[model samples]
Every structure is written in C-alpha cells, then in structure tokens.
Target: MDSVTVEGRAAAELLARKTSLAQTATDALYADMPELTTRYGAVGRERCLEDIRYTIDHLIPAIDLTQPSMFTAYVGWLDDLLRARNVSTREVIRSLELIEQAVRNELAPDEANVVASFLRAGLDSLGAVRREG
Candidate 1:
C-alpha cells in the first residue's frame, strides 16, 4: 500500500524476471574467470545461476532500507561461498559486475538499479575482503 512496499514488490518481480538471464550472465563471467568456468563446469554454471537466484529468493525480499545489515550479510555469504570453492574475491566481484551488466542491458533503468543494489553490495563486500586480505 505504501511506496516502499510497492517499490519492493516491483523490484522483486524485476529480479525474478532478470534471473532468467543467469546463463547469459554466466557466459559473460567466464571472460574474467575462465579457469573457474573450465574447472567448475556444471557445478560452476550452477553456482552462477545460484548467485542470481539468491538475489531473487533472498535479497529482494529482504531489501529493507531500515535494516541494511541483512543485505550486507547476504553479500558476505556470497563472498564466503565463492571462497569456499577456492575462487578468488576478484572473480566473485567480476561475476557480480557481469550480472549488473546483464540486468542493465535487458531492463528498464529503475528496475536495473533495483537489482544492481544487491549486486553492488556483493561487489563492495568483495572489495572489503580484498582490502583485509
């Protein structure tokens, strides 16, 4: 009923539709993470898709402006997940960037920004980790 609720719903729907492009995003990701593409194969592909799904299934629902820490935690988990697979934080950042590019290419400006927020958060977390390490 309120604007925030409406915006969240619209952003949620946009993220869901945009996830259908996960495979394309994965291909783009391989440009920077070629080793991962070859090494991971099907598992790598699934992880790429899961990145998109996590934004859709989890972050989008919890995109609350009041509680920003949840978004931060989600992105942290993504970084952890990639590291657990022996992938570098740089690769994870690039993967998130590719997803942002895919969303920008296919959707409206506002919708792209909505989805980009989560992607950017992931990127930021990766940067933080890079700084720490």
Candidate 2:
C-alpha cells in the first residue's frame, strides 16, 4: 500500500479504537447514573455525541494529513470543545478510564501509548488555545 493509505488506515484504526473507548465510557456513565441522560436532556446528549463525532472526523483526518503537531492541534480543538461544554471532571476521568480499558483490550502497549499521547497532547494544546482565544 502507499504511504498515504498506510497512514490513513492507521489513523482510521486509531479513531475506531477511540470511538470504542468513548462509547464504552458513555455506556458505563449512563449505566451508573441513569439520571444523567435525563438531567442533561436530549439536546445535551446530542451535543456530546456531536463533539465526539467531530473529533473522530476532523481530528483523525488531521492526524492522517499532517504530522504529530497537526494531530496535537486536533486534540487541542477537542479539549476546547469539551471545556466549552463544561463537561465535569468526573466525566473526563471516566472517559479516560474507558480509553485505558479499551486500549488494554485492543492495542499493544506501544500502540496504546501512541493513542494516549495523542489524546493528552491534544487536550493540553486545547487548554492553551482556549486560554489564548
């Protein structure tokens, strides 16, 4: 396969894995606190899903199209998006835990690190961007 194809596939896999993680996290959160779905309202749930979808769409493509910096930028965008929504810290932690669990289940250690680093860097970059913007 061509370099672009290879990169795209890798990025796709990364995104799929991330989506799985997010879904797992969301499921667990909903299961634990059934009220959250109601408290947040349908619009809120839709917004949250939209944010996740946006991350998978825009952020993953950036990773495939550019280098690590671009990937970081995407993550930064996600961080800003999440923060703007005022997602709770507990929710963030749950998401991270779900990511960790999914990574452990589906990826090798090194691969998992790559995914985690991308997420962490993106979050950090987003924080900086939010502060400046």
TM-score of each: 0.76, 0.57
How many clashing pairs in candidate 1? 0
Candidate 1 vs. true structure, TM-score: 0.76
Please tell me which predicted candidate would have the highest lDDT against the true structure. Answer: 1
Model 1, range 38-82, lDDT digits (tens) per residue? 788887678777776665455555553424456667777877877
lDDT of 1 at 62: 51
Question: In model 2, what lDDT does residue 19 have?
Answer: 64
Cα lDDT for residue 83, model 2? 65
lDDT of 2 at 67: 57
Q: Which lDDT values do the candidates have, in the order given?
A: 0.67, 0.58
